[model samples]
Target: MSKHKKAAPQQRQEMSGVERLGLRVSSMINHPIAQTQRWVVIHRLDTDGEAEWEEVIGLLAETPELDLTFNDDGAVTVRWERSALQERDDFIIDEDNEVETEVAAPF
Candidate 1:
């Protein structure tokens, strides 16, 4: 047998902007400073563009885990609704998890 190790399968891919933002939000909530934080700040870079921001916010709004509010300075504040999140624990979408999509191959 050859002494070379086999290449690992390409299982991991780069995270999208929204996915990264989601992870950040999760981290903030779990952080110790979250105890007194009333608002979770999100800058433009978090979403890349206005359209991307809209899309990210739109997706989060659909879930009951968190609430998002826009600030005058163009930052987004995130509010976690623990009860709602607990209830949706069975299907919570977080940074570490990937949303599944099925695509049919074009013949």
Candidate 2:
């Protein structure tokens, strides 16, 4: 037998003024038409946002390959470099079961 009990569904709650304002203002930030698209994180509660933001900043700070900077206007910059998949050399297996890089023809 289980010790836990199934609770009844809670009643719906109305949105607070702060929540409504936050949602409205927060929505305007990423919606600016200057940039066609950008990544965004939406948190329903403001309480845990600080910790999450700090974690992201710490991750960016500790990673050597990642570029992390905070602008004076509260803008954050994060970018990284990666080799294109097409730039990688192809591989082939010989009848003798030896693996070798396939040579490319010169243009």
Candidate 3:
């Protein structure tokens, strides 16, 4: 007789927007090694078509925990674990700050 095991139910944990984005950034930076100059862009559909590339770069620059490398071809790559986490947090924080500012501003 063949033995079979039942799969366990998946558990979903509640995470803040910052935490969610942090997870995403972590996953991206942890991707398998590839060519040094291939740039990976993360795009958001909201904010009137604004791209998050510069924000990512800035986060990398500001945080020391993240080891960000730029290739001669102008492609940026993140290769460290802690750095990835820091960058992710920075992105989320910056985004939240921007939203708060926009909400408080008089149009």
Measured by lDDT, the strongest candidate is 1
- Write one digit per residue (lDDT tens) for candidate 1, span 11-99: 88898876776666556555433423323566666337566677777776776666788889887777775445545554333443322
lDDT (10s digit) by residue, model 2, range 1-107: 99999999999999754556444433432232201122222332454355555554565467565455576654455443332211323311122432343432111
Cα error, candidate 1, residue 50 (Å): 3.1
Model 3: per-residue Cα lDDT over 11-107, one tens digit each: 9988754445545654554433211211233333243112354554666567765556676765555544433443454332222221212121110
For residue 54, model 3's alpha carbon misses the true position, in angstroms, by 1.0
Candidate 2, poorest ten consecutive residues by summed lDDT? 32-41
TM-scores for every predicted model = 0.53, 0.33, 0.33
The clash numbers for all candidates, in the given order, read 0, 0, 2
lDDT score of residue 37 within candidate 1: 37
Candidate 3 global TM-score: 0.33
Candidate 3's error at 16, in angstroms? 16
After superposing candidate 3, which stretches have Cα over 4 Å from the reference?
A: 1-24, 30-51, 81-107
**Model 3 whole-model lDDT (C-alpha atoms):** 0.44
